[model samples]
Target: MSATAAERQFDELASLYEDVAPWPFRRDIEVPSVLHSLGDLTRSDVLDFGCGAGLSSRLLAGRGARRVVGHDASEGMLSAARQREAKEQRGIEYVSRLTPELEQRFDLVLAVCVLPYASTRSELRQMCASMARVLRPGGRLLALPLHPDHAPDPDYYAPYGLRLVSDTPHAEGGALRVELRAAGVEADVTAWYWSRNSIEEALRDAGFGPVFWADPWPPGLARVEDAPPALHAYLRRPHAAMLDCRRARVSG
Candidate 1:
């Protein structure tokens, strides 16, 4: 599998990613919403698709997943993941791609902050297809793709150490080039913006059932206490969208 532009970008940033990703943002803002989407995973075989630095992979393993595997296209990211695995000894497996051997293996797959790097419709569809192939019958896929509406307001992402340098419109939706400053280093990352209809269509093409979009903050869950007051409103608007999809159960 050739490295995608997005994968290469992540590989370059892998070293600095963990340092800037605050626990408060992960536990308070991201995890809570993801957990609400995933009711329980006590014994499920989970796949952390595009598991950058294996953060979510560890999260799954810690949450009692029976088997947790992380797949990424970037060796730089995988290297970080391996280091964490060695330190934590969580027994999680880390691989480079969704190989054919993994077909119909996982009960739940989380591909957060992935997919948006597709940069093209074909790539988007192909990514979704890979997710479909890895899923067991009736398995669920939790997709966190770039939201169509991103950084609507000026200085929207500054509080999070990200600056929206450009938002260029495209046929698919748009391209967002963000300058992320973290750990005393800065990098520019470009992500493809996929529209809701396009994402849903891709999921259907990948043999998934109807796609369900989740609100950024589900009802009953309060805002992250540590989140900056300036970011609260933008968080409510969603820089990324959560999609819930399920593979069809094979009939006997």
Candidate 2:
């Protein structure tokens, strides 16, 4: 997708995004659990990349982050976040710019459902690098993405989305209306399913020491009927199945 188109796509989604996404929004999980597992963030500066409507950021604030900043590429989303912030009387700093005006060095960075919208690997890398650049040595990152191991392929490009064999609303024959990316969006725009080695390699390449991995199938969203056995067993086997990793201390 062209830069302009990419911007417009999110702008449109921001218009009625909240209404269509209420249930999952209410069920959001990875954010808090990941934070808690990392221990106290009360005195740490935090950054929420792809902050979306700032729902997760608000959660961080309630958890008592020293200072929180959210950055996204969509102005409409930022506006929505601003509205929410004003309504709740919270003090999150939301910016539409991809890179926030931050040099204070964050102790933690939280990203959920980011990377999917990235049109290319480079964009994803840039975002990762941006986080590494801003984080203090030893800081941790908790990232969540929609393209769970069994993601419903977006745009039918990558062929990784959940394939239903039963039935559901948006889906009639196969598994269910769980997923089927429209032609409008490119497969590349969706977060490519990064395998364990790839993520480790990418993180190390970006200067982040590998900590661990988490929820291959986060219950944050509805379950896909045809999710592989490995996916189901992992999510249900133990809530702590996901990875919890950290970077080494700064050497400089």
Q: Who wins the TM-score comparison?
A: 1
Candidate 1 off by > 4 Å: 23-25, 167-173, 182-185, 218-231
For model 2, what is the C-alpha lDDT against the true structure? 0.56
Model 1: worst 10 consecutive residues (lDDT sum) = 164-173
**Stretches > 4 Å off in candidate 2:** 1-8, 15-17, 20-32, 98-101, 146-148, 151-191, 216-244
TM-score, every prediction: 0.90, 0.67
Q: Top model by lDDT, which number?
A: 1
Clashing pairs in 1: none
Q: Candidate 1 residues 76-119, lDDT tens each?
A: 89999999899989999999977789999999999988988887
Instruction: Report how far off residue 108 is in candidate 2 (Å).
Output: 0.6
> Cα RMSDs of all predictions?
2.5, 8.3
